[model samples]
Target: MIKLLSLLALLWVYMAVVGATHTADLSRKSFPKGFLFGTATSAYQVEGMASKGGRGPSIWDEFIKTPGAYFSFFKHLLEDINLMVNLNFDAYRFSISWSRIFPNGTGKVNRKGVAYYNRLINYMLRKGITPYANLNHYDLPLALENKYLGWLSHDVVKDYADYAEFCFKTFGDRVKNWMTFNEPRVVAALGYDNGFFAPGRCSKAYGNCTAGNSATEPYIVTHNLILSHAAAVQRYRQKYQEKQKGRIGILLDFVWYEPLTRSKADNYAAQRARDFHVGWFLHPLVYGEYPKTMQNIVKDRLPKFTKEEVKMVKGSFDLIGINQYTTYYMYDPHTSPPKDLGYQADWNVGFAYERKGVPIGPRTKLYEEDILCVQAYSNWLYNVPWGLHKAIMYIKERYGNPTVILAENGMDDPGNLTMSKALHDTTRINYYKGYLAALKQSVDEGANVVGYFAWSLLDNFEWRIGYTSRFGIVYVDFKTLKRTPKMSAYWFKKILRKNK
Candidate 1:
């Protein structure tokens, strides 16, 4: 009886403290009339019934199975689909692992795979949540990756269009928002150029210059990806849009680049970085060609498109989904001739490595120090909330403020589940608060920012980082496959309820 009384007392104090500290009522901030507030996940990350759905192997399947693949430590894959569907997400954004839909990536349709996705989509709809489906999310069929040079081969574009059409025909009526690709830049750079991701191959090292091969492979892959996206958009516009009344767009992941010193050189370098990162994809979709900066920077290193191709690429999206994480500082070259004058020359500029200029929060210097960027389980993710705000503003200013959906954004930490899973996650909470506040500010300033979807709904396979990093608001015990919502989850739920 005494212990129960004490527990009640503590809970009361906790609620009082929370009320005092957090002022933004999520319930009051209900998304713009028809706006969405949900969480997202990917198929390969959460759906572990890899072999059950007649789903042929994806690059992830092969990558994860490799002897010393980064995430091999978590042998807890092959999770049950029933359990995953019930994981308690407001809304879930996942991909249709292409291999699962077309086991061979082309001719035969995998009925079992189709049924599995149908089940998942039906379950979400039944739960009163929307299903934001992506046609591809980094898990290309291994057969395509090997037989065709994946996205490098223009044929894969047609194959992808067919696959996308299949998805629309199958799930278009039920799913309202369809994303053509999750993050094409990451696919091209990580999978093709850096050789860190699956089908890992450095085009420069291989010297496999087939019709589509060159140092320009990343740009070429992007061009084909754009073509594939356009084909899907065009098909949906013709066949499904009126009947389905759904929206279609492609999700592009971007990192904001700022000039380290406001000099012409630094500014030019920063612009170059943005052009390569965001413009490489956006310019093609919006303007019918790649950015002139990228063209000039890469010179002949990028592939050229005919006039007809340009027409096909432009104005192809109903909306643009952007996934932004961090911002970087750019530096100018000291030498006369720009360092390498190669495709990747601009990335040589320095970054905002130290947290000197970052804005501050109420409690800690960790929040203020621009030098102490939040590190992802993967070295690539450096956290900068203001970067997200800057990114949204840039998109609004540069691209005529298209309806922007923040498709993915979150931080990751790898440690035992303890207080870290509970109250101590102020870092994650602060990150969201700061970024959301900035997003809210953008909306107030007339940027057409429509929605924000946290990067993950649960902790699952984090690609190369494997299960080492946990980014989910709900803690998933890999051993038991039990999901316990973290404090952040509770907080976000409150925010959602208030916003609603």
Candidate 2:
């Protein structure tokens, strides 16, 4: 519990440095009619009972024994939906764990697992919340990983498509929005290139791991991921989308890369970063090939899609979900190429958080006036709202103005703060204010942006970071599994009010 003095000090910090009146004049009224507002959570992140309910082990299930968000979502289904209804949210974006549906990744269906998702979807519909379901969210079935090395081999592509088809047959009637995969780039890079996440694999030179080729595995994994995504979309379109009338897409994470200076080298370096990041996945989905920068640099190391695969891969989505978070300054490293090459090393660029001495975004303090703060929640997230604008515009101009959704956008707070300090999330409120304003500006300038969903609705297991950071507007007490709305939630409630 926070002492009275600490609470007073926090309140004073907000009122004095970060004025309480900084909430912008923005609301649902500020955007186009039918714009979506929702919060996102992955299955492994929130829906506990990882081993129960006939659910098979995801790679995540076997990797970590430290449980987070282990409270039964199946037991508290109604309470969660009620919370969404009270907040005036339009939708809830959640992933269906692949192993939950098919315990062994293939062969047998888990009836209990199907029932759990059906209950969750039905409750959301009854509460007037639209369901936006993602098929995969970095939670691959352990069975697949053990079978043919998961995404490393081409065999898993057929299995993934089969699983996606099963979900369409079972749940497509109610779930209108479908995403094949969430951040396949992250899956390839962090899981293979750096060995940072679950099913950890990396070359001996890059990280401590039993096995993996940092140079080749990342590319091969990404190739299989793209193939899996396209195959799923193909099956949905050919078999279910016509009857179900639902749109399917893939979610990709993008960070706006600004050149540190006007020098040609730096500008090219920044482009290389963008090409190697989002373009790694999206370029093929749009143009039927990898980015020129990548093809020229990595050459044979980067996989190529055949003539038949090219036809299947191009124009694969009705929409694209871009998860915009922060911005980084890029500069030419101007160093000799290392003999040890990896996915990130292929970019050949240097990342800078600041230019000269001034910071790109202000370093996080207890409070700041101009809404410039960096490293608030995680090391990568900076409070540069303009990054959202630039990211959306880039998608528009480069990708032929495709329908876009600002899918996962939000910052986080420390998990150890007392209830009083945690509840008063002024920094978070300011974050939404600035980003939403930038999103509105993009729409005003003719970007075909459709929806926005926050990074999460509740604090849950955040991959390698675990529960050390809280990214939700609703605070969850880990001990009792009780959820209390933080000030940011109320801020959302106020702006989203029908009268406002």
TM-score of each: 0.84, 0.94
Model 1 C-alpha lDDT versus the unseen true structure: 0.71
Residue 450 error, candidate 2, Å: 0.8
> What is the lDDT, from 0 to 100, of the residue 334 in candidate 2?
100
Clashing pairs in 2: none
Worst 10 residues of 2 by lDDT: 366-375
lDDT of 2 by residue, 25-63 (tens): 799988899998998989988888887888888888777
Name the candidate that leads on lDDT: 2
lDDT of 2: 0.87
In angstroms, how far off is 186's CA in candidate 2? 0.6
CA error at residue 264 for candidate 2, angstroms: 0.5
